[model samples]
Target chain A: MVAAGPNRIDPYLIPALDGVAYGLLVFVAASGLVFCFGVANILNLAHGMLYAIGGYTAAALLDGGWASLALALAVGVLAAAAAGVLLAGLLTPVATGNHLTQALLTFGVALAGGSLLVAGFGPDDPRVRVPAALDGSVVVAGHRYAAYRLVFIVVAAVISAALYLVVRRTRAGMLVRAAVDDPEMVACMGVSPTRIRAGVLAAAGALAGAAGVLGAPIIGPGTDTADTVLLLSLVVVVLGGLGSMAGTLLAALAIGEIQTLGVALLPSAAPFLLFAAMAAVLAVRARGLATRWRTT
Target chain B: MRNEVIRWGRGGVAALVLVGLVVAPWVVDDYTTAILARTLALALVGVSVALLTGVAGMPTLGQTAPYAAGAYACAVLGSRISDVGVVQVAVAAGAGAALAALTVPLVVHARGVIVLMITLAVGELVVTVLGRWRSVTGGTDGLAGIPAVRPFWGLPVLATDQARYLYTLVVAATLVGAVLLLLRTRAGLLLRAGRDDETRLRASGHRVPLLVSGAHVAAGAIAGAAGSLLVVAQQYISPADFGFDTSALLLLGVVIGGTASVGGALVGAALVIAARDWLFGVLPGHAPLVLGALFVATVYLLPSGVDRARLRPRPTDVPPVHPDRPAVREHAGAAPELRT
Candidate 1:
């Protein structure tokens, strides 16, 4: 892929780094979906609304200053969590319904939530301003990269590591894993599956919200941001295989790379590349890249 | 004599409905006729969804793929061919069916959720391709300047909104009637059985995948025809016309009208179209909030749809039991004893 460049850095390296950052952001957005679908068995189609809310909150509140940016991010995450709780409450009645009903209900919520955002923020594209500290360029391997993007990579990596530890090591994580494997068995063991599910939904909502705030600078929050994020997350979850964390991470990173590289190489065909890759993956593994855990 | 009377009564009702549709545009304003035409197109799509999700028990969000394919086919062919006639619609339907045939392997034999996702992916992919193929699809601007639709057999072209409305109404009603008739056939019964329990259908030696694929193809064709009708009605086609939102709206209409009922699809489509048209006119940007809330309420309160009121279960409406199925018999026998 390298053309002519002895002293100059390979052009692909920047896009690759950009891809890593984008992949990490996707992982953050999709991680919650993986948890909710795996453990709670609820595919929250409205998860993107939470991300949009977070982004909007940040965009509206951030004054481009460092302190305000931090505060805005915090507030945005909290707002997203609240939205999540509201979604969970709304879905509680229909949780027992078939997947189709659940999907429809969540879709309704998404529609309403999206419109509400439009109403509150207006239809104008609102973007979050990067903090002053992360505003300039930084040298990476002799190549200058956006400081905000590098910071994003570090922050997302930290979040991913923490999330991995929590899901793999903690008692709550153990409960989540058990519930995912078999909710009925966990219920029989004395834990209320509904409560666990609600908690997971809330946590997943928070993660989506955080991703929204963090990703707003890179992706830019707009009227259709929720739909775009939702589609990407769906791709990530499906490509990773439903309810598989490792699969989501890997799939997210690969998709992030494909998206960036495709845009760089073939701008016109960029959008289809992610989907074409997904179609190829699904063709090979009909169930996705990874299979779900089977108790039997 | 009784069967003859019942059939005559049904035929009379059908004839009356057709007469009313033909005469509707004359009484109503052009705006109302345009709205009615839009409603008819949407209703066709709703029927397609009901056929797959309601009758066949496969909830799909991929109908937009064929719908867009049909519209794009019309936009491309109609623009090139100078004279757009009924034959163009047929070609559009073929395009839709071809897309459905391509997607059959991905959707058929998959689990319910997986099927939904795969179909959704297909729909998204179609939209993406359309948006990227700038030369043909015109990218985001979409294809415009489609010729006015001409009726078959050297008939006068539908130049006015009223004529288009009448045309859409006739096509939609025919498709609805065809779907209703299809539901009465053995294949329809097999679809319903597959919906209720695919395993049982498979055990009974039916090819469940093939059955599902057939229903999908039929739905795709219907949606394709609807898309062509939409283009005829508006004389414009865009990628945004057949996006995920439209798919969701169609599904919502199917659910609101009552799944598995032909009449329900019509009622649901009307409600959706009216709400979209009127509410957007009245509230502008706030229509989505209202529509969204209405959808959630409908799903929560009217799970079966507005047609539920007319379809109350009668005391004699008992589920049929297969006498040859020993497993079913054993389960039926043990159920009451365990309760007792």
Candidate 2:
């Protein structure tokens, strides 16, 4: 986008606009990661496959109508949520073990599940049918922008606001948070921590599924979709510094801009930007969280 | 009496393996020999993964970064600078060590999953660069037609499968022996101490971070040498050779090999790599499903696991406020052990 003063349209505006939607999409996907890894302390590596479950559901079911969208949303969320429950069950054996054990289990599930999905869905990148009303691009400040992409803005905001309320206001969220902080106390208070774990996984899956359906038109469903989503969500989790809502939102926004506007500004350096940002952010975070064992 | 049998069993296995390596080319088909050579290179990389994960307590998913660096360095060097195997390996190791030294600060302080994540990021960064650096890395199509390498300046170029396999075998065995010897020294003891309890190691006035940095560079060099071997064996190099799938398999192989044992790492890595390669060839699309199921099954049935000290859920080890864990805030002692 060349610098245009008065008469010409500013090209940065479109990417900047797209950046908001992309950031919101990332926020929606990453919240589930924060819930599982951040709140529950479960390193669920298959979170992306769960999101892909929803993406595939959207691609297979949606036919560009409101009712189809609803049906797809319901089926996608339920299927992904069911997968989450299955993952929770699978995790039971190695749940108390170190992160590597959990990683082995989760990554196994992801690889197997992802392969089965490809086999079932056919080895092709299926297209998502956006709702008929939002199928075409809308003119925004002289630039035509895909209307389907804009849906992430309001949906993500509502989801984040609702998530904030639940974690802050609801009794269930309190138990979940308390379970993470002190499981012994939660057990003493007559709650099964296992149930909380399953619930958290299911909730995380739902969030990922919702994002999958909503963002499918943008990210799409393919063999590599699960991996890409997983990595991006991980980056968001790391850059967000883990477990903080405000931090996660800001980090998602920063990543979204770097991916969109940053790419526009420096096309040649596009591929390196995300990982570079991730490496730098993670390195700085490590220094700050330098082990308490240093002087213990 | 039990000790005698166990020791004899280990010795017998070692002797059998040595014999097998020596006569592998004579018994196996050319195709199998090529696969075995590739697996040998990967097994060497697996040794490096073990050096970090088993000995240093830093689980990684990014050693592929250095592996790729070494492979590309060897490819470039073999084409432009030298086609000598030893020289390529040395250059590749240097490239890997240099890369590791640069990224040491990013990974040195962290422990547990954070280290895994950071290393994974590092690997991904290298991959992205390889896929995009069109003029140099050939932009995902990868650098093909790499020249054949001579094992040494005076030796003939390895033109046959048997010769290539033998060269790879000799190099891998030498590197593995060196790593095993290194682990027996004081440097290895200090790394193990740091892994067990960084606080205690620090209190004793040990430079824990420096030890980690050294280990990181050493592993990088080892992985880099493996890269040169890969080029010599395959005569082609690609980003896919050092991808996440390879890294994951190698890491898991090291775990299955018994993280603390170099010989175990070589065997474990060879087994997993061989299984994956064989499965891919035989089952085609069904490889991942079968492998995934096996990993999950291994986690449950073999609960004593790869790192027995780490995987076995001991109440005494994971204290409520254990600081060694990456995320110290979580209540790790929540889950009840299915077995005592």
Q: Considering every candidate listed, which one attains the maximal lDDT? A: 2
Alpha-carbon lDDT of model 1: 0.76
Worst 10 residues of 1 chain B by lDDT: B331-340
Candidate 1 residue spans exceeding 4 A from truth: A1-9, A95-97, A287-296, B1-21, B82-84, B304-340
Look at candidate 1 and give me any clashing residue pairs: none
Return the lDDT, model 1, position A128.
70
Off by over 4 Å in 2: A1-9, A95-97, A290-296, B308-340
Per-residue alpha-carbon lDDT of candidate 2 for residues A106-217, written as tens digits (9 for 90 to 100): 8889989998988889889997888999988888777788877766677778888898899878998888767656677888999876787788899999999998988888
RMSD of 2: 5.3
* Candidate 1: CAPRI quality band: acceptable
Over B1-340, each residue of candidate 1 has an lDDT whose tens digit, in order, gives 9756645655576567667778989999998888878878887887788787767766777889998998888778888873545777788888888899898887675544555677788889999998878898999898877878777867877889988887788777777778777877788878777766566677789998899889989989988888888888888878888888888788767767666666656667667767988899899888888888887887678653422111111112244344543222111100001000
Candidate 1, DockQ score (0 to 1): 0.36
